[model samples]
Target chain A: MKEIAEKVVAGDVRTVARLIRDIDDGMPHVRDALKRLFPHTGRAYVIGITGAPGVGKSTLVDQMISHLRKNGKTVGVLAVDPTSPFSGGAILGDRVRMQRHSMDEGVFIRSLATRGHFGGLTQSTRSAIDVLDAMGKDYILVETVGVGQDEVDVVRSAHTTLIIVIPGMGDDIQAIKAGILEVGDIFVINKADRDGTDKTMSDLRLMIDMDQKKYKDGKWKPPILKTQAVFDQGVKELMDTIEEHRLYNFKTHGDLPFRKRKDRVGQELAEMVKARLIEEVIGGLVESGAFDMVVEEIVSGKLDPYTACERIVIPVLGKRP
Target chain B: MVQKRRLRVMVAKPGLDGHDRGARIIARAFRDAGFEVVYTGLHQTPEQIVDAAIQEDVDLIGLSSLAGAHRYLFPRVVEILRERKAEDIMVCGGGIVPEADIPVMKKAGLKEIFTPGTTLDSIVAWVNANVKPR
Candidate 1:
């Protein structure tokens, strides 16, 4: 285990993948692995790519990765695809399209399934990002589950969020949910090869212009850029816009960088607490048959679940106060 | 909430065979068994299979094909994985592979092959038992 941790800290690809699996599988010793990895994390520039499905978000990310690699940056990609909300299974085909970077030792890509866990984020997402950050990546791209709307969690988790919109969204352009509109640090009009590209850009510009509260602080205006990700066009300008946004962020919040990390720390702790409560408190009780008596009582019809819960509430957890 | 350490399996269809019924069933089976399954859509090349595995970091790659090209294409995935030193990933296949050719494919580094009539239970159990922990 120590050897694995050492290798992961040394940026060994195999060990990094294995440890991430450990975290994904909820292995018992994952805590120890994460402990060893923690000190090495929180360094990578985390970027979140989000949009409605088929906005060419995946292709754009694939292009962005190649560009980043050419500029001598080591990259890690996390592609989040929504699993069957019922079955917890997903068709994570994003990597199939990203085969160009398969042999590149500098890039580590992993697909994450929402797994019946939601909140715009999954618990495993943080652990996965930490593993990548600890592995010495220059940048980490988190492609959100593209399920749209509730995915604003990316804004919380990523330092920069890129929202991709294709030209000719028509009514769909107005259909952009309020949550999606507010999270973009940068907007992209993908499939610029298609007609109505200018109309799409103008519509987005007008919408951004109307969001008065977004510019009240006058910090930054989300730039709308164009791209034909399949052909790899306009990606260089997209990267330039991202770099400019990164600089803008640092210039604005550099003095209180710790504040950002502190926010992340708070989020991580909340997630850990939630997970622990579910596993240790709830799962332990169920496994220990503590719920059996409650079940029996309910089954006998003498006790309603609410009544039984009230009866056992104090025993299960010390008085609320 | 805490999620189970579900095994992740990638079921990919390589070559031009578009008979996705088998792949879809297996993907659903793996999911129902509480394992995460990622199924690559049809017409994937051997390179795409290997790349998907590397990127997704899956514990198992189940290549589903009815195209009679398993003999030629299945081994190519294993070979590329070996070349990249990703032998830790378990490679398996299903869909119309002949029983007689199973050993030959295994010899070339295909870990297991499940043809028609194989139960999803058996495949799930095999994975639980044989997946490399790394």
Candidate 2:
């Protein structure tokens, strides 16, 4: 474990990749490696790109990687695709668009399957991000599975979140209705050569204007940009804007972004606590058949769900005042 | 709780093969068999495929070439994997390779070759029997 962690910190690609796979597989010993690696993280600036299917997220990410590389930044990318509900399998095709960077030493791209996870990312995504970060990547770009409104968890982990939309999806009302709207640090209208580009831009502009009052305290205002990702158009401006946002974060949060980092770590800690409770407490109940007895009682109408809940929790908590 | 590890496979169409129906079908078959399939679309060089396979930590590489470049491209993937110390990633090929070249390919470190008329079931079965996630 020590060897693996040290190799990952040394940026050994094989060790990093294998450790990430172990993380995804939910191997327990990986926690030791992660503990060793934790101190080495927080160096990589994380960027998240999310949008609907067919919005060219991968293409834009590819362009961003090239631009970052030219600026001498080593990058790591995690592209997520959904697993099939029925087969528990996934065809992770996002890397197909970014394969050009595969042979580049400075660029490491990994594709993750959203393995029964619903939050636009897999269960291991946070750990995988730490792996890449500890591997000394300057930037870590996480592209979530083509998302709908509610898969906004990417915002929790990323320093900057980019919400991408293409033309002709819908009007300004669609933007307003989406839960994703509030999460964006930048909104990109990709496929701009398409017909409704102007309309989409205006719609986004109006939406941003309506939300402008929230930024009155000198908070960063999300900017809208038009891009033709396939043609590599307007991507340079996107990179510059991302760098500007990174700088803004550094200036406001004093290099460490203490508040944002605290939020992320707090969320992670809560999740770990929940998982441990499920594994130890609930798993013990199920193994000892107490859980089944409660379920049977509920099914027979002998106990209501709320009463059964108290019956389980009161034992664990020893009768609250 | 220990979760069962799923086999990850890379379905790549190496060389300039624009015909990818075979590759896509195999990729879907792998998915149906509960394998995580990373499909490297259309034209990819051996180097790109090897690099991706390593980074993904995939257990197998399914190379499809209908463009008759399999003789060079298929074995080249295995060669590069060996050179990169990733020969643990098994290489298998499908599509228009003649029966005469099968032995040579096997000798060149391709674990198996599936010509036309191969059923998706047999491929999945072979993978199930052979590939173990590292």
Candidate 3:
């Protein structure tokens, strides 16, 4: 596992994936491995893509990846999806659009399931980003499952979030405004060749102007760019806008809001501790047959789940004699 | 006696399908049934799915496509798996899979198809029976 971690830090995709599995499995060495590789991360520029569904988010991301590649930037993509209820699997089929980059050694693509995490981004997305960063990718693009709120939370983790909107969905503007309109660093009006492009762009511009008035100081103003992702129109400009935003943050704030290296490392450590403690407690419970006992109680209706949790936590909460 | 490696399964949803109440429930059940499950969140593509399976070196790829693209999408996933030399990993699918579509899915090399309301025991049994651990 240590050897694998070293290889992962050196950017071996296979090793990185294996380490992620070990981490996901709550393997004992997972945290240790990550701790060792933590220093190797934070070099990659993290970009997030989000939007409402049917807005061609995936198409636009595909275009963005190609654009990044042309500029000699190694790219990593984390596309999150929801898990299926009956199959216990995911229907994550969006990678179909970017099949051309499947074999590119410079491009690493991973799909994660949101699994009812409501935040749209998978917990695993961060770990996967760790892998990409260690591999020394110049840029990492994280695409959230475009379900409004989750998308917003997921993109909040990115250094630059580009919210893709399509023309003709007058309702989409209202919906996004009600949800994540303010969260975007860059708003992309994709499918620009589609009907109502002009109207949609104007409406978005008006909304942006209206919203900007709320902030007294001229803080972050999200740039609204028109793009036809399928035709690759305005992709270069969009990329430039993303860079411009990155530069703006560096110049004005002296730091990027999206690249909080300390916060991420702190989060990783906290999650590790939480996972470890849970494992220890649960391992003891299962070994003591406490788990089976609880299951039996639930089945027999002797204890409701809320009370059953109390039964489990009470013992752990009490100090050891 | 040689012990079998614990079967690791990756369950994922691809595309714009938002209905995941079923996927989450199954992930919990599979964990109880003693399989190490890696769930890739919704809206994943076939390439990403296969890439994950290959990277995880999982024994099975359990896809749940409830949005009705199973006919067009499932087969393409199998093709990618073959290309990645992961054809040996048993492919299974679930999630609103109509009884009628089972034949086509099976023909596409999907070993098992679990529909809605299927029990976790059945899924465990199928994995224990069909999957050969490498």
Candidate 4:
């Protein structure tokens, strides 16, 4: 395990993947492996690509990977999808959408399904990010299923969120739901060749202007780039915009040592809490058959599921007051 | 560190498929059988599933595909694992896979296929017997 961690620190994808698997499997070595790899992370930039379905998010991600690779950067993509019910399975079609970049060694792509979990994010999305980050990818792209609100939550994990909208879908209300009108660090109107794109861009511009007026805090406006992803048009400009955002953040934040320190501390705290809660659930309670007893109680009509949950949680987590 | 327990299994969907009751039931069963599960959100791709599998490093990959595209999708995943040279990973599938296609799927390297109405106990037992902790 120490040898694997050492190799991963040197940016080995294989070791990184294996270590991630061990982490996911809740192996004893995982925590130590992470402790060793911690110093090697924080260099990779995370970019989130999300939007409503039919907005060409996957194709755009493929193009972005291609563009990044040309500049000699390693790219990692996490493609998120919805789970199927009738068949406990996935169509796994996102790879087909990214066929052009399939052979690229510099590009590492992974698909995550929203199977039984409800949140906008996949259960293993964080672990996948860790593996990609540890592998030393220059850019990590997270492509979500693009189902409105959930997309927003997933994008929040990224350093920069790129909300892609097609012209026809960019209505006043949709602009809010797609979270394009707010959460984006950058806006992209993909499939610009389609009709009604100019109108969509105009409406988006109006919304942005309204937002700027509403805030008036002198914050930099997120740049909106128009592109037709099918033809690979306007990709260079989009990449340039992303770089500008990075440079701006770097220059400003590098001068504010405390802000960076605070952010790092907050991130670590959140990660620690997450790891602890997961350990408690999977290790502390679930393994002891306590959870199953509650399930049994609910099944036998001794208690309702909600009450059972309250009973279990209140004792373990303690009272609020 | 917590003592290692049962293998954590993440049964995931890879694309725009919305059928999840089956996946949820499987997750519940796994929970009952004492395996940790991390269910992804929906419409995930092959890459996302593989990435999750690689990261979570479960003892097995259980995919449920009702979509007709599994023929194309599953192979690509197996190929990626092979390319990563992590082909020792166990792969399994369920959901509307016809018995006729099972042989072909198994030949293509999927170890098992669970048709509709497979008992939770059987699935759990198979996994326990076949996939041990590393």
Q: Choose the strongest candidate by DockQ.
A: 2
lDDT of 2 by residue, B48-81 (tens): 9999999999999999989898889998999999
- Candidate 2 local accuracy as lDDT? 0.86
Ranked candidates (DockQ, high to low):
2, 1, 4, 3
Q: What tens-digit string does per-residue lDDT give for candidate 3 at A98-156?
A: 65675677887765555433221333467667777877888999987556455565676
Question: Cα deviation in Å at residue B94, candidate 1?
Answer: 3.8
**How would you class the docking of model 1?**
acceptable
Expressed as tens digits, the lDDT of each residue in A1-321 for candidate 4 is: 678767876766557656654543456666677766666667778898887777899889988888999899998888776655543444434654675464455776665555443331332465567667777888999988556455556666677789888877745436454444566888899989889888887877877777676545546688779998888999999999999887776765674432145765586456557656656664566668877887888889999977876776677678942
By TM-score rank, best first, the candidates go 2, 1, 3, 4
- Give DockQ per model, in order: 0.45, 0.65, 0.09, 0.11
Give the C-alpha miss distance for residue A259 in model 4, angstroms: 10
- By summed lDDT, the worst window of 10 consecutive residues in model 3 chain B runs over B1-10
Give the candidate number with the greatest TM-score.
2
Predicted candidate 2 versus true structure: per-residue lDDT over A29-135, tens digit per residue: 99899999988888898898988778899999999998999999999999988789899989999998899999999989999887753231434787899899999
Runs in model 4 lying further than 4 Å from the true structure? A23-28, A85-88, A115-123, A148-151, A170-175, A178-180, A214-218, A255-268, A271-275, A282-289, A292-310, A317-320, B1-134
Model 1 chain A is weakest, by summed lDDT over 10 consecutive residues, at A114-123
Badly placed stretches (over 4 Å) of model 3 are: A25-28, A116-122, A148-151, A213-218, A253-315, A319-321, B1-128, B132-134
lDDT of 1 by residue, A134-247 (tens): 889989999974454335664457888888888788777766645677778898999998999999999999999897576776579998999999999999999999999888
Tens digits of lDDT, candidate 3, B32-133: 665556666677788877876776567788888889998877888899888866687778889877899999999989888998778888887888788865
Residue pairs clashing in model 1 are: A25-B5
Ordered by lDDT, highest first, the candidates read: 2, 1, 3, 4
Pick the winner on DockQ between candidates 2 and 3: 2
